[model samples]
Target chain A: MSKLLIEDKEVVIPGQILAEGMDYLPSNGAIREGDNIISTSMGVVSLSGRLIKIIPLTKRYVPQIGDVVVGFVKDLTYSSWFIDIGYSNDAVLSMKDATSDFIERGADLTQYFSHGDYMVAKIANVTKTKAVDITMREPGLKKLYGGKIIEVNPARVPRIIGKQGSMIKIIKDSTGCMITVGQNGIIWLKGPDLKNELIATEAIMRINECSYTQGLTEQTEAFLKERTGGKQHGVHQEA
Target chain B: MAYTKRLDGRKLDELRKVEAKVGVIKTAAGSAMFRMGNTIAYAAVRGPREVFPRSMAKPDTAVLRCYYDMMAFSGAGERVRPGPSRRSKEISMVTAKALEPVLDLTEFPKSGIDVFIELIQTDAGTRCAGICAAALALADAGFSMKDMVCAVAMGVIDGTVVADLDKAEEDYDKGPVADLAMAMLPRSGEVTLMQMDGEASQEHIIEAVELMKKSIKKIYEVQKKALLEKYGGVKDE
Candidate 1:
């Protein structure tokens, strides 16, 4: 007989059995044994019909194809710039995908993108050997200049971004800071001044810390309002 | 003469006081501290990131590397010499083997996960303590693991089989003491590590394994509690 060992949204640890019987299918951070579906990470259980998955509380960012990532240029090759997207290996951002500008071979690549330059790019492909390829040709993807970057737990990136960008939208509207959150958990914040950027950073960090709690959006909205103060034009006043 | 009484007054099947806490080191990717009686072990996990020396990087799966060390003042009898000794290196290897089974690093090819286990205090089972701490640290670091690996040192004192061996029992001169450090995957009841020192008969070995099986479950509970407390309070069930 099929049995569900855990309720939806329950916190589970590695090896904890989530369900029994072949009727249930395990996905994500969970795996299937002979007849039992067990968790393979320390995370919360997310149940959807016959599918059972675990949402890990903490995990290293695994770059996937088509993921928008913030990366720092580590080194420059003749035709490519090695980008560190907080992964095990450096990603390759070649000249063709680097920009729309036409360039000659070995034309001093540093003149375009140099060491220590951060850029918001998209993962174009990942080779079988785990070589990552990122691109900056897409709109809204460019080299971030003079903005502060802060890292958060990659797992919390979704919560920081919120439902359809609601949480981030609230923060942006209040602080008037341009916030770019990368799937790799690296955030770029550039505001009119350092104070606004700092406020945005603190709000993002707070969301990262308390991402597991309920009513996070409301808490964040109140927090941004309090920090930015109600007098600011960006701070929305309730009727 | 039969060794009837435990030196520390614990029952033959009873373990030392177990205490565990996760996220002890804020800087580590995952860190935990586990104390079994007087033996205290702190474990920190780093990476699934780039493998150093590049040549050592695996193309299909991530490498699990462990470093086991005992602090100078942690020993009960004498100060432990700093640096990686032959004993430490062996322990480190066994530790990696014990934890490698549950970890699924296939998703992270060309990466390396390093587990650093340090004994802050020692009373007999330092390696076992380190293993326990490292398992918890790996889980905390959010690595995919099949199950938590629990370890404990079971010893045969004279004719009696005991659960957790303390320093005094290890040093008991009145009887032949045989130390057996074992690690097991609790759910599967699979023994991942079994290293015996001194001497033991077939009957004594069987008895020690039985005691270990029972004690391992208890250790698993403690490890589970440590992880749950850090992530969220224990759910009623």
Candidate 2:
């Protein structure tokens, strides 16, 4: 007989049995082993219809195509600039994808994107060997200037963004920071002053920590309200 | 004369008191500390990040590197010399092999997962303790693992099979001392590592394996509790 071994939203570690028998299917952080479906990572169990999946608590960033990422320029070659996007493999941003400007052959690529410069780009392609290629040809995608970056656990990014971007909107409106959250968990915040930016950074970090708890949106709103002195403080300042 | 009683006044099949904690190191990707009796081991796991000496990285799978070291004051009888020694090198290799079976690293190809284990105290079963701590840290890091690895040192003293020998038991001079360290996958009861020193009879070796399996179940409970405690998974009884 088919049996459900665990309840939904229950935290399970690797090798913990989620279900027994062939009635259930395993996916994403879970796997089938013989007659039982077992979790392959430390995560929360999610039971959807006949499918069993695990939502991982913590994991490194695995780059995917079309993911907006904030990265730093690490090296410059004649035709491309290498960016470190917190992935194991450095992402390559070639000349044509780097900008809309026409360029001569073997031109100095550093002029367009210099080392230590932070930029927001989207992944264009990833090879079978995990070689990543990023692009900046899209709108709102370009080098970021004078904003500090902070990283959170990549798995918690979805919660930070929240449903319909409401959670991030609360933080942005209160701190008055121009926040750009990359899918890889690297976040950039530029505020009217360093103090405002630091407050926003702290808020985001707090959200990242309590992402798994219930009533997160309300908790975040309360936190932002207190930090901004119960009002939108930097709305008048230039971002 | 027969070794009817344990040196520490414990049952013959009993194990040392085990204490386990996870996320002990703030900077490591995953870190854990495991203590069994007087032997304590701290393990930290880093990466699926870049692998140095790029040539050594495997294209199809991540390299699992383990470094096992004993601190200068960790040794029971004498102060351990700092740095890699012949014994430590061998232990490191074995520890890696013991943990390799449970880890699935194909998704992180061309990278490295480095596990650094330091023994802050020692009585016996140092390698086994290190393996247990490393397994917990790997789980804390959210790596894909088939099962947890639990280990213990089983030995024969004066023809009596014993589980979890401490320094005094290991140094028992009344009879031939046989020290056998084993690492097993708790679920399947598959032996991933089994190293023996000294000598034991065929019957005693078989009995030791059975006792090791039973002892492993207890260690597995501690490991599960440690990982779950970190994420607040434990429910009130």
Candidate 3:
């Protein structure tokens, strides 16, 4: 059986056996070996060995074609709005790709999208010369307002969201706040009181800090209770 | 105008406080974080990986690739977007060239070296800061080089040439302010990379170069001091 290191993490390629007699894999603090296999790139592994595969992380946010993200309108031109997607160049949101609703000519663009107004968008195209175009026509894509935004390392976004939305659901339920996480590392939290908003922010921060751990839902729930002087209410208990 | 004073109330040739640390990231093969005045930069050097793209790969020497990025939160006022801009791309290219003469790329045949510089906070002269930080990181990663390339920026403002320009001083646009940034081999007194912007007379340019020479001398001392502190003064030849 052939085994190789993918990104410095030991992984058994599909149709290959993880080296025998090797159970404990070195932890680089990102991923651990012997973790249950979830998805495979190609074929399934036949032999059992504790091997962990690592995913490369990046600090800059590059817009891949067809990636759904949320961004803020930084500048408005005659035909498009320059969207700040936390990338080097702002993504272009053309009028054709805007909402279906009618937009007036020469009207104050702020009425449609003021500066700092957030909107969920999809990367439609990226040119070879580094022009990025975005669209807001997809379902559940709209402008975001009246929320407290928190930023974190974009690489930890998937970990903060958790599997099947369980972690975010818990935070929303416990704090009674509406939370929306943009894939580009922008998190919006809106609640009645500043206290709940702070709690939600702290919870998200905690998730970002300890993303590798299991049983994070229970840990987050307990953390919320400790921070809020007891359960506030509307916290859903998973069956 | 030749103002006989420093912007930070120090002497004309006084440099801002400089601090450097190595091995900041355990994951990276070599890493360093450095601060000059208010500017902060971090550098990580990785690889001896097989060259890619086939065409750019060198049979006799290892290729060097550099990525210099400025964090959005590094500057005050409006935050910048992450990733490389045109200016940063130019800086990265120049920095790679600055170290090219020093590195013994022949040792790693058909391989490449990657230097990644992240500007955490920028005041002024981030390129120089990045070069200094990258050199330390390269050394920390056990890469052999002839001599460390030290860089510094000097500028002429208000008829007076300053050794190091701060943010405010750099932004002053009233006069024909010119900036001269250079990377030099301290021991050999060889120029590795040099660039000048704005308008300056030949005399002013020569004066700025002299100032940069002095500033780089001090910077070289600091660089050696930092390495000695980290590696116990081994003084790798």
lDDT of 3 by residue, B1-237 (tens): 566665679676677888888768766656788788999989998766545676886766678888899998999767888887888889999999998886765545555789999998889888888888888787666554546778878887766777877787777755667777788877556888888877788888788778877888788777767654554333246
Give lDDT tens digits, candidate 3, residues A153-208: 46567777778987888787778888878777778778868988898999998876
lDDT of 2 by residue, A1-239 (tens): 99999999998989888899999999999989999998988889988999999998877778999999999999988888999998777999988899989998878777899999999999999989899999999987979999799988788898898899888888888888888889998998888788788888988988876677889899888987787787775464232
Worst 10 residues of 2 chain B by lDDT: B75-84
Clashing pairs in 1: none
TM-score for each prediction? 0.96, 0.96, 0.49
What are the chain A TM-scores for all the models, listed individually? 0.95, 0.96, 0.72
Q: How does model 3 score by TM-score?
A: 0.49
- Show where candidate 3 strays beyond 4 Å: A1-239, B234-237
The segments of candidate 2 whose C-alpha lies over 4 angstroms from its true place after superposition are A233-239
Candidate 1 lDDT tens digits, B16-124: 9999999999888899999999999999998877887999988899999999999998887688996799999999999999999988998789889899999989998
- The per-residue C-alpha lDDT of model 1 at residue A162 equals 90
Give a tens-digit lDDT track for model 1, residues A1-239.
Answer: 89999999888999998899999999999999889998998888888889999998888888899999999999988988999998888899988999888898668899889999999999999988788999998887888888799988888999999999999888888877778899998998888788888888999988877678889999988887788885354553221
Leading candidate by lDDT: 2
Pick by lDDT: 2 or 3, better one: 2
Q: Between the candidate structures 2 and 3, which one is better when assessed by DockQ?
A: 2
Q: What's the distance in Å from true for residue A205, model 2?
A: 2.5
The TM-score between candidate 2 and the true structure equals 0.96
